[model samples]
Target: MTLRSGAVTALLTATLIASTAATAASTPAAPRGEGAGVLRVSTSTPLTTAARLQAAGFDLVESRIGTDLLVVGDAAVRSRLGRMGYRVTVQQTAPTTERPVSTGRTNGIAAAAATFYGGYLTADEYVQHLSDVAAAHPDLAVTRDVGDSWRKTQGLATGNDLVAICLTKLQPGDCQLTPTSTKPRFLLIGAVHARELSATELSNRFVDLLANGYGTDAEVTSLLDSTEVWVVPVGNPDGREIVEQGTTSPYLQRKNANNSLGACAVPPTSSNQHGVDLNRNFTWKWGGTGTSTNPCDQTFRGSSAGSEPETVALSQLMTTLYPDQRGPLATDAAPLTTPGYMLTLHSYANMHVIPWGDTTTKAPNDAGLRSAAFRASYYNGYQTGQPGQILYTVTGSTDDYLYGERGVAASTMEVGPNSGSCTGFTPAYSCQDGFWTANKPAMMYLAKAARAPYQLSLGPTTTSVTAPTTTVTAGTTFTLTATGNDNAYGTSGVGKPTAQTVNAGRYFVDTAPWNGGTAVAMTANDGSWNSTSEVAKATVPTAGLTAGKHQLWVQTRDSSGNWGPATSAFVTVG
Candidate 1:
């Protein structure tokens, strides 16, 4: 989302023209120029201006709902907006030179993934990484070919097969498409816009964390044992390939590589590109606000709802993974026992975008959704709200579709800061580590919450769990301490969650409570669990345990009868 800054403007003269023609049969006239730049147009009615510019085939960089519109185009764009009687300023011009590519491997899971632009993985590399993970961790990971990308559907060799990886400790009914599976499912999709390079990297790291940290990391091991984590790292492979081919200045392609609709300019610029904005092509609330009928525009909703193959493939994958827990009404809330959570990762906004993205209306399960968002933000410190409240409105987005049609607790994570070295769609590779460090906890929290998102989100969280000694001899006793906080939710966003008293706390050995593990009561440090935060301690005996590591899971309950997600610490019997 970061653009190179420049000084450019034009005098007011011509009137604004609204163009609608966007097919192969007819082409609407537009302002022509040499290079693209980000233009900020001051308008009294920003939303109306955004709609007009989108309809006229302008790529919107960002819209400050009430202040101004950030449009991306060339000098002609600046002139056109200026002549339309609105004061326009150039924020940044597109970079002219290509970024240096890197071949250094930063992590072990996907060594081949580092052979792309500054360590970012290509679409093919991402799919190969999934295969590598599945091969390396056969017991815990499996790769599935979900569907074909748009190009592949068109019988083009340049297309890619949509691939996803499921990570969990395999059991009899695990990783199946049936909605009645025993384990809760968490789905993470990245790079839906194709140009958001960091999204795919974060997805890869999450996979690596779960697949590699299974035996050593207690928290990850417990999650893998009890929950199913699915990741589609390259959601728009065709568009990502187009982005990968940008050796001379990264091609800012925001959509899939489908070029049959409109006569978009050849050698796509930052602003003028041909393809459907896959985010706007979903079935729910399609062709609504913040979308364009113009095929060349960035937010183009295709010829029909779910017209693009990529959109259809993703929607189908969701349907296969989750059951419809909600009734067929916008006001019908998903039951508290809903067992799925979904997150679509984007870049540069640094916000947790919740459902009802097409409008300002609150979702049916607004409290639950807000609580979950606040919990995630507690780790990443990102702003949380509906799309219209933080970024501009977006229709037919992945979160809205999943939450609306499938009744899954879903949201979109806009990664990266608004202004920094790590900002924008194409950030420096070094920024990946820092971003991963900041977001890993949030990702883990969301994945764990997938088990009972609505109910668990309202309960007190196990902030920390620890064992006094890492290694213990067989037939010995050890002390385990855990801290629970009913106020762990983030307070930087709308709808502050009310904190309840920590009524009770308990621990289980080597098993999750949902799987019928026997719970052991823990005594609070202050002699009672009557406060918002409490430290509970338990004496665990290892008399019959074998000489190996065991997971000590801890959970806390609120006064409202809600048991929070479990956290774990490792204890090894020597």
Candidate 2:
């Protein structure tokens, strides 16, 4: 959900109304109404009505297929929808106009949190945090200037650099801006729509999790050693600065600071604002459904495809980091060996949106995409589908461009629930930790799935690998246990995939099977692998092993012969 309109002053109120009506000709105007809030509108044709509302510049929140829409707007919006013959119900009113003051803790996580808002991070703070993380963990993280923001390119004083941080074990060619790399890449882009505060904060936490948990956490250690995780926090820094500058309330700025065309209001309101919607300014499926030609509208597609500097820079970065794996046809599917995965975070939409967002038509690799989305959504409990099937038809989104143009496996994760303290565009600061805890496992799953997304996503998952003790003496035998499940896919939304039986399981000591480690058979605890869930165990012989920490990698295979992603447990042979 992008914009929420409100009156700034008595004098400019009329002008704002006129501007909104003039720009949004498709939208009907009603008498001036008080109070701005969220609305749940019931409609028999949800998909059609969703697209209609989007085209009319309504702030349509993400909703499940065949369900009533959740919209954020004022009384006029309600009246207009009423005239259009829809039943609208107010969900909740906007918070008070008084901004919540921050305590301003200068050390640790509080420092990165927003000064005015307690949980969210400002654009400048996010950039500083990236630099601080890189400085504190040089061996595991490096920050790069991907491109310049719109204001920066315009030589404005308040501009910022489009920065990205890559986290991995720094090998010779690691983190370089090259398509060829020694390890697979998982790129997480956040806050492309600047008002989505939780997106940026989530990215920040992900960086912290991987960079700080390197050696101590077995999963994080194995992931960083085998994959390059990239984070582009605060993608629209200029607009984010405007959002940070909000005094009375947070500015719902959803676009870049390229106020070159329209006579938009100063200190942008929810409805009338100048700038291109960065998410809608991509080259693929540009200027289509769910986008507006009006510069004042929230979903304003730029003057041309990839017109915004931020959009161009992001596309260029993806091209540099990921090779084109699919053919030029719309029906062509990327191979199962595709090496990169991408997730763009948005707000107020509890959805894991797959590619081909502009239409309900499934992508060429819909099976793999849905499987991966379902697997990730298992942690977050989000609905998974194409944007048209889940929320509304969105064109020129980053996920669509990355998947359609560059052949990368990409999806958009709309964070936060529809209702609660953690809901809405600017959720309460206290909601950050809860959201992070809920999303961490899902993010980790997607990061690990980047290795072979199409193939690994189809197999059973090795949920856990455990030993009775992490430390053991030399020339000793220890039992290793693991839990494998083929039914780990999420069933919260449309297209619930069928689960397969876990037919086989194996464990490898000291090395991964791909690295020529010998596989040791693990017998099922229940004496058979006839069900979707299985518990397997094995005894490892450490007689010939050297005295040091060794990784025990465990993997499971489904009855269909698909090998899932590996889970590692460390055993110290001291």
Candidate 3:
């Protein structure tokens, strides 16, 4: 997400690091203890180099082929690599420092808006906050305990239960996983990487705004009435607790607390020995090019696809909310009929990346995904594209898993510090304003867009039908006319080529006795519609009718994959 400032300098640095590549070192047993200090290691390829570093038990700070890795390890790391013939350079000698926790938050409703900017909250505080809102507004907010985090499952005091909050006026099956109703859905997940604290804060604030603004805000009320906004504010509670432990200068823990993988040879011990990168643990493209086998490494794919508890739970939640809206393979684009959208927030990179992160291959629904991301970026000003196109290749990521495997329209929003005044991983509490202010509109757009995420918002109605009389003789031919507009017009992020045109319609006729009819495509020009409200006509042949009365039905499908509301015209045969 952070494009290195000096391209030439970065390339030279990366080359210097790669040149030191030596013979593959023998795999060492899990470190008996942690190592310290910082080292810069480089590889010819970003993805492969990262895999090497992680596999070697190095705690990576940041990495890319263009930007040599910044890692944490002691002199033994240097010695081992020296023996292996790989070049290693000392970047810094000091231990990583923590950011001091801010003491400004009150966690009270009166100051709810201020709480988001105050500081990051503890896992318990987050749970309490969700409960508080649900308690205060029973009709508008509700919380569900989805599952227990890894730490909780381990019987540790630091572990916490996973929770999801639904902010909509409740009705039958409103928040349940069952897809029984007609309402559209938007799912927002935050803090999957424990170090990205702002994600959680932003999610919490969104929950607060929606639950509190119910009747007071017209737009919010209408949105809730028609759509469901589900938020999982803390997606990785075990890892979050580790990061929270170092409140003074929050500990940097990128993965969960599943210590089955032993500690890295890096200091600040606890995080190194445990956890899988929940982001890389998803089933789709799991264990592909940009992941690791070393459990101690930051981007380690778990023992198997969907291996981690966090991964399993979140994936289950997503499936529970949305059916596989797209076809089973890569060529199958999500049906325009699908009505789900997902956004998972991360930080330190001011970018909104579309799916297909597993490789450079474009998704079948790439057009819709790119269009939505570009439109969403208008409000936040974040660069948008498939991750492999804009950023580096990342396998088994949440967005890719959601979109590729489940056929949901999904993206990852890297929340803060695009460039100027870069705050890096944990930006100060004061910097929250810049993020929230810029993202408000984009977030709201996502909520409204859920109504028809994959479809163009166009509906056609039958305007008129002409025939000889109400009792037209059998074998008589007549015409039916109807009009429709691209309802998406004038809406922000809408009306692009993808959302502005209607393509075809299925036109059908039923005889006087109302014989069960098989529908067929409308013939010729009748099948196509254009303009804001253009009239489309269908010529009907009553050759097979039994006389008496008959009915005509027309339903149009827009170019953007939406089926317009059905329109009907009645005619009689004598």
lDDT of all predictions, in order shown?
A: 0.80, 0.82, 0.65
Q: Candidate 1, after superposition: displacement of residue 35 in Å?
A: 8.9
Clash counts for all predictions: 3, 0, 11
Report the lDDT tens digits of candidate 2 across residue range 117-148: 65465576688778889999999989999999
Looking at model 1, report the run of 10 residues with the lowest lDDT sum: 8-17
lDDT of 1: 0.80
Clashing pairs in 1: 1-424, 1-425, 4-92
Cα TM-score per model: 0.88, 0.91, 0.67
- Of the two candidates 1 and 2, the one with more favorable lDDT, higher being better, is 2
lDDT of 3 by residue, 456-538 (tens): 22333222333344576677777665554443222322123344565555666652111344666553354435554445656
The better-scoring model by lDDT among 2 and 3 is 2
Any runs in candidate 2 off by more than 4 Å, and if so which?
1-36, 64-66, 97-114
Quote the lDDT for 149 in model 1: 88
Stretch of 10 with least lDDT, candidate 3 = 27-36
Q: Cα miss at 183, model 3 (Å)? A: 1.4
lDDT per residue (tens digit) for residues 230-261 in model 1: 99999998888777655444567889989999
